[model samples]
Target chain A: MPSLKNIAADLPPVQKTRRVFDGSFMVLLVLTLAGGVAVGVVSGWARVGQILIETFEFIAMLAPKIGAGIFIAATLPILLPRERVGRLIGRESGVRGLVVAAACGAALPGGPMMTFPLAAGLGVAGADLGAMVAFISGWSLLGLNRTLIWEFSFLPSDLVWTRYLLSLPMPVLLGLAARAVMQRRLA
Target chain B: MNILIGTVLIGSGAIWLWWQLPNDAWRSASYRASLDTFLFTAPRVIVALLGAGFFAELLPEDEVRQLLGAEAGIAGILLAIALGPLTPGGAFVSFAIGAAALKAGASPVAAIAYVTSWSLFSTTKIFAYELSFMGRQATLTRILVSLPVPFVIAAMASLTG
Candidate 1:
């Protein structure tokens, strides 16, 4: 009888395929462009000119923050080393790791567009699944940016605090749940 | 003196022309509503930027990546999920981080889980903008609705990954 190792070794390598732009995305893009053209034509050249000016004004208003975000994103990879990140948050073998993982997850910035690429790069550099999950989890729920803005704007302090308090434990719960699901599948 | 005068004349003429443009009467209501939304949301954007800067300064990315990459067993998976919100950058940025974690040996399931949670269940944005703009009921409903999406998506992705 063949050994388990031998049987495993004999299995065919999984073929991976690159994700392509799906029909929905293409359709959406086409529709958007068509709409823009229709609006411009219907509105006339003067209106189109006004629209462009308005668009520029909007861009100008957002330029500073957007520019800073871009700069920070560019520098993130260099600032954080892969090995150190792995060592600190990747060892998810027990309860301690789980707690640390949750904390780490709540700390990262931006949304998936920025975090996903960075996480992938880290994976390429040799990060683990647990750490990746923690990082992703942390990025979603914890927002120092949102907190300060709401606080300054005269929104309810209680609401902000309650949300923060409630969110603190969610990542850990989600992580554990995900683990159970994954394990069940593996089994 | 001549150049300064020319510049002033041009600037004022440009402003006058812009102000004189015919406005869309039909779309005005919707446009105004969108403008109101923008005005209401502007402060949140400012706060988000400041928070992003603070995150960049405080928690080093290298440290974060390492934690997610090493010895990720069941516990690690749970930890990663929990940390989804705190991770820096946005959805696109987090995706990159997810990719990096995967390259470093993170499981595909955990990575997908992290991405889903990161995008859909942000605590910081909820407290600051979602709750305030839409009110507690709307915010709570969104959070409740969004909470499960990542797990469902991640579980499915895990099977394929």
Candidate 2:
């Protein structure tokens, strides 16, 4: 029989698909148009007129957010220097970096959607797996947005505080667990 | 003109409330916290809407529900967590879907898990941008780490329920 490495190498190459016109994109477009039409029909022509006006207002509100996202996306790679991020939060071959990785990850912004790309880029630039895990877990578990929203609403003060307090330990735990898994995988 | 006038009136009332509030009270804390939350989430909401527009064409609700329905059990929960990275809508849309799933007799834990996962992850986003910036290892690591979080959160929620 052929060697394991030779066998692995003999596997067929996977085909890479084009990025555009994926199933999800088509679905999103249909939903938006359908939603627009539904809104227009439900509200009537007069309401449609108002909606048209409101749409412009909504677009105006959206402009800044889009700009901010672009800015954040652009700046994150630079803001958290790759070497420092790696050293501080890198998922190295060792275990100590795991805890550090988790703490640093939780403090970063933009949630998994935004951070995933950033983390991947950082990894390319020499960041470690530990840091990336910390970052992902941190973004998911921590909620700067929810904390702010809950504080503002009519919700009970203690309830919101309790949730935040409870959530605080999760990022650390997740980071540690990930590190343990990684160590085992490596070993 | 009426809309403009109403906007101005609302703005002024908001200002009046700000002016009237004591600087350090619980009410002030609540208002500040809410404002901060709005500021934080507002951008994500925009991203979600754009993502919704992009993803609306891909997965239908029926398919989503079918995949993660009550009949699926832990498999459904795992599928929901895995698929979380694919969803693009904000909490409003996610919550609406979760409510519908609950009504359809999906386990409360599973529905909550789906919502939490959807809120936290998106595969389209990962492939489109994250991988480019964070690199494959980091991107993959993050995705792997996030995979189980929703289940844990959902489990906790279920326990209370």
Candidate 3:
């Protein structure tokens, strides 16, 4: 199993001041301002007012779901420690390991800031590239938290389901493919 | 309707998990973590949602449809896949853009392609996190292996319909 606590401890310190207003947030702000100003200029002030009102209304509706998503992201790590998760996915091999890792990835909630670090820890935890790929791909394709709070809220339910079902088998397949490629290189 | 159901399901699951924590210390630690996460996440979420709103309005729907709508066919799907990585911001931005495009007449298959591609190849995540953590080769390997996924998913989605 991986000594994940050590790996996590080794990660570069995240500056609190830089957390929210960093490059990603700057990009978001710049784009939003550009879009808002563009719409105001081209579509008129009245249209801008209407869009802002609609945005607020939508936010009100989404508050509960958003709150729940936040809680899940917070509580999941405390409930399921990285060491335990590492022990589970680590030292395990083959198709079963990939499946387990994929499931863990899907179940784990958080953004890339959290997910990537945890994944890096999985390296020390004994997970091979296949398991690691399975984990990352699973989160990418089927993150429960994102799908619940974001995807279903935005897309039509049927469209979401169709895409979801279609994508469901993918992480495992990618894991298998990664394994094949690695094995080929080794041979 | 979907939002309500999802909220309830996720909320209850979270509560249940909290209830299952071994003791008061763990519960307190979890709560502390939640607060910290809320501090870190809430601003991002609010800003992202607002940004998504502005973007939805600014998107030239008619133009987007011309580029990625039903009549646009395979080419539209390909274009959407291409655009996924180019999109700036987080998941909300992409999903909001996807929703706007759908409303603006983009195909469902195209939306799937867009979301899948964004998940895999978003340059922000790639450069900032993956490359730094996983190194260049592993990152490239994942990208190379994952490259066909969105296109294949879009094709399969179309077939299923």
Error of 2 at A61 (Å): 12
For candidate 1, write residues A1-187 as lDDT tens digits: 1111222223222222222343423443454345445555665556545544554563464444333333222222223333445456654455456566556545443333335554444444444444445455555555432233222122233333443454566555555655554455579
Please tell me what DockQ candidate 2 reaches. Answer: 0.07
lDDT of 3 by residue, B44-94 (tens): 766777777777777787888899998899999999999999987778888
Tens digit per residue, CA lDDT, model 2, B1-161: 32233234434533433443333442344344334445555544443343333233233557656766656767888876765555553433454344445554456557556655764565555666666766665556556766666777756654565
Worst 10 residues of 2 chain B by lDDT: B50-59
Residue B4 accuracy (lDDT) in model 3? 90
- Candidate number of the best lDDT: 3
* Model with the higher TM-score, candidate 2 or 3: 3
Which runs in model 3 stand beyond 4 Å of their true positions? Answer: A1-18
Q: How big is the positional error of residue A75 in model 2, measured in Å on the Cα after superposition? A: 9.6
Two-way TM-score contest, 1 vs 3, winner: 3
CAPRI tier for the interface of model 3: medium
Query: What DockQ does each listed candidate score?
Result: 0.03, 0.07, 0.53
Q: Identify the runs in model 2 with alpha carbons over 4 angstroms from their true place.
A: A1-30, A41-99, A111-114, A117-127, A143-168, B1-83, B89-111, B134-145
Best by TM-score: 3
Model 2 chain A poorest ten-residue lDDT run: A1-10
